[model samples]
Target: MASPHRKGSNIEGILDVKRDKVTVSPLGLDITWGGDSRYWRIDARYVELIQVCWLEVNGSVEMKHLEKSTKYKLEFKIRMKPDAFGWNDSPVYIMAMPGKKAKCIWASVDLSRIKKSEQESSLIPPRLEFTTPGPESFHEDDRMSFGLFEIWKGRWKGGLVIEGVIISRA
Candidate 1:
């Protein structure tokens, strides 16, 4: 595509998730008028389909009940830019997957003070594969899900821009 939006364009994009549908574009991802990476970087991942904030409030999609008694395979992929930002440190990507208990899926490469370029891959997102018990197993009648993503720079931080998709099948 046209690379979405140019950096430092003072624009914000969003991801709209709907039933049987998911769309992702670009966002400002930073507080600066120009999307500049000073300390923080970018990270993107996908998770199981759950209650989308926008669609839920508008009643655009029916709340499908997930049988927690069954088993589900949740997959996510994450990536980050090593340097381009004005950061002197290399940050790490810490991933978390929620289940019966909160679980740490994997940690990205530790750049912390490691000499490297800004365009390298500081965080190497490993293949995160996990399984979950169906909704029927839960005591509640509501939909069951897990938080898919969280992006940040270890020391100095700035705007975090991320992109990805979540897929679920019965």
Candidate 2:
């Protein structure tokens, strides 16, 4: 569901890794997700974690779709439900690599910092910044693979809503 939309004078490129397009570990059995009427207007689907000890959500975007030589940031748009648990001390890592041969870059963020509210509200998630390779260094088929992970904790966690991953100019 990634698309380029027009900005005032320039096109602000964006890549949206929607729930359907993301690869979720332990899908269906422990995690349930799909489109809902509430998000119909924005054309967004949501992934909810029922219960899981290992967590990993991954997605990627093609470099050709982005403006060359420009810096971009990637973020996972997520929210924690009121009854969410097991994230008190768990630190999730956000990772990204410009291309298959590139070294991976990652940053850790504490999801427990997000305040749980009665309403479904979005939180300012952690971001990983990367610069698109210049034309001479870029390849048409190159891709930027990214993911959110909390696999080592091995503690049961639930009530997490994954809206999607957003990649935009930094």
Candidate 3:
């Protein structure tokens, strides 16, 4: 993976979200719910099958972290394995922002089709995006936040490799 974009109009490479950086919820608990940490070809050594209801990874960049007045995207870096099960019909959830009132949104991955096609995970990965405040509106502690959470859709989810999440200029 490459470093993040540093300028307003720059096209940045992937800002990888490594496995060791994940911050699981419930305090003091690890994110060993349905999957394990391992290496994959997509990116680096990361976690997988993170199907827990509160599985999350939180990260914040420094002041002027991204280019001012640029549009950036938050992507959930993951892969679909052949025996990977679940996650086809079920919707995944994500929450980003700096405060508690952040709205949760639904997301999905159709890896079943990818398995049949044997396509590279990099070709397409689930992601979310938001526009950065222009230089005028830029403020201190303006962090970009996002993560995948379990939905209350009344079923368990499994079968996905989470190499990391990335934020880059769009």
What range of 10 consecutive residues in model 2 has the weakest lDDT sum? 2-11
**Residue 10 displacement in candidate 3 (angstroms):** 25
Candidate 2, pairs of clashing residues: none
Per-candidate local distance difference test: 0.29, 0.62, 0.44
lDDT tens readout by residue for model 2, 1-170: 62221111111233323432322221211111222222111222556666666676666666666677877777776778898889989998888888877779888888788878545656335557887777787886887777778889889887777766667766
What's each prediction's clash count?
A: 16, 0, 0
- TM per candidate comes to 0.34, 0.72, 0.57
The better candidate by TM-score, 1 or 3, is 3
Please give the range of 10 consecutive residues that has the lowest summed lDDT in model 3. Answer: 2-11
| Model 1 quality (TM-score) | 0.34
The 10-residue segment of model 1 with minimum total lDDT is: 53-62
**lDDT (tens digit, per residue) of candidate 1 on 48-154:** 11111110000011113223343332322222334323233443433433343424454444323433432332212333343334454344423223222223433
Top candidate when judged by lDDT against the true structure: 2
